[model samples]
Target: MSHDRRRALARHDKDGADRDSGGDSGPDRVEERFLRPFAVAAGDPDGSGPGPGPETLDLLTLVVAARTPGRSEWLRPEREAILRHALRARTVVELAAEVNLPVGQVRAIAGRMIEDGSLQRCGPSRPLARKDILHAVLVGLRSL
Candidate 1:
């Protein structure tokens, strides 16, 4: 990870620690600690520069373990956590929720992992709802 990224993560950790110790509680603190980095990374809060744009991966996109192992030594602690969590099939949102990191940050990290073969993007495959299946069966029975 870059120096700036490391700093941001460190700050995030500190913010979490502070919140745990009852140092700060409110939306302002949450926004400062969580959303500021994204705004800064996007260049401007006003959407002036290149911005985050549409290149960011979808939160619901599924991720799976790659055929090859990643070089853990080359990864940051945060990225290592992400890779470990991805040992099984998980979505980008799932990974973020597991690690308590912002979805955008997780997406960026997962994108790098995909590029370097540490992870693979998988197609979304949620199971069908049981209620929906039963409803369809009932409709079919009525038609019969």
Candidate 2:
């Protein structure tokens, strides 16, 4: 390292513990984006990869938290992350991006969440009017 940079870093370090940037000198930025499927660690029901299959979640399936719980102590870390992102109503793919997991993993976890009543499916992920699909279809093409 250059002498000037080393001395400047040392001075900053001595200023206070609160000012330490943990080796970084700039605002936070996402330096990497990679899948960490191991954290989820699910295999096929018949013992294969965790890749999506029988769970059959369409890429566009909309997911929304069925209801906000006061405390969700029973959910796994992956499930919890999924639910947190679902509160805003996004598709399985979108939720995958939000949680930094693969789309297949998110779909699998989301399907299980739906079955357990932690999440509710309302058809397409887009935020069309009527809120949940339970509301009447007021969009055009009813005449078609």
TM-scores of the models, in the given order?
0.47, 0.48
Give candidates' CA RMSD values in order: 15.6, 14.0
- Model 2 stretches with alpha carbons more than 4 Å out: 1-54, 69-75, 124-144
What are the Cα lDDT values of the candidates? 0.67, 0.66
State the lDDT of candidate 2 residue by residue for 9-75, as single tens digits: 7677653332355446332322334343544543223334534443567888888998764355254
Tens-place lDDT digits, model 1, residues 6-113: 567558786644554454563466776544245323211223344334335688888886753455624356666777788888989999999778888787667766
Q: Record all residue pairs in model 1 with backbone atoms less than 3 Å apart, i.e. clashing.
A: none
